[model samples]
Target: MTGVPKILMTLGAIIFVVGFLMQFIHIGRLPGDIIVKKGNTTVYFPIVTSILVSIILSAIFYFLGKFR
Candidate 1:
């Protein structure tokens, strides 16, 4: 029970840091991401960034679990 709050706080801090970095880093503009721009409309998707983030987070969790 006590560990739940600590985990939530850690996750929140990680999310806050990522949000802060996204403002300065064009993470959504990485190559392989989809960007459609029409005369008056624009759509964007960060596929590559999402994959990279997934892999990184998976590795982090895997290692942490191993250590535990």
Candidate 2:
């Protein structure tokens, strides 16, 4: 049907927009050191590292998808 192409295009456009937004969603960012000290115990939270990992992974996915 003639409507099929139009429907598919619309869905593709929606997927593009959603994927674009996802590129900006910071899954990990620090407000501050993610731990506190009451004079004992030391801990750490990995936020910046995760952001970097996400970026690398996204880039790889983007390129692989393109080459296909």
Candidate 3:
């Protein structure tokens, strides 16, 4: 019960910080990300960013599980 709220608060704070940093960081433009542009059209995909985030989250959860 108490742990639930603590976990929620920590997650919320992490999300907030990530969101704030994203405003100034070009995370979507990292290497291995895809970008297509035509005269008046553009498409973007953050492949590397997705993988990096996935790896980070997986590690975080793995360690948390280990501790528990």
Candidate 4:
């Protein structure tokens, strides 16, 4: 129980920091991301951004598990 709370708090803090940093870091508009504009409708897909985020998260989890 105690561990769960600590984990949640840590996760929340990480999320808050990421959100705060995102204000200055444009994350969704990577070069490889798809964007389509047809007349007035625009469709956007952050494929590259998703992959980047996944890689970063995987590395973070790998390091955390390694340390644990």
Candidate 1 lDDT, tens digit per residue, 1-68?
Answer: 98999999999999999899879987667899999999999999989999988998999999999999
Q: Write the per-residue lDDT of candidate 4 for residues 1-68, one digit (tens) a residue.
A: 66999989999999999999999999988999999999999999999999999999999999999999
> lDDT tens digits, residues 1-68, model 3?
87999989999999999899989986677889999999999999999999988998899989999998
lDDT of candidate 4 at residue 24, scale 0 to 100: 95
lDDT of 2 by residue, 4-68 (tens): 99979988996897689779985444654266556687567766766766898799779979998
Superposition-based RMSD of candidate 1 using all C-alpha atoms, in angstroms: 1.6
* Pairs that collide, model 3: none
TM-scores, each model vs. reference: 0.79, 0.41, 0.75, 0.91
lDDT of each: 0.91, 0.74, 0.91, 0.96
RMSD, model 2, all Cα superposed?
10.3
TM-score of 4: 0.91
Model 4, which residues run further than 4 Å from truth? none
Enumerate clash totals for all models, in the order shown: 0, 0, 0, 0
Candidate 3 Cα misplacement greater than 4 A, ranges: 1-4, 23-25
How should the candidates be ordered by TM-score, best one leading?
4, 1, 3, 2
What is the clash count of model 2? 0
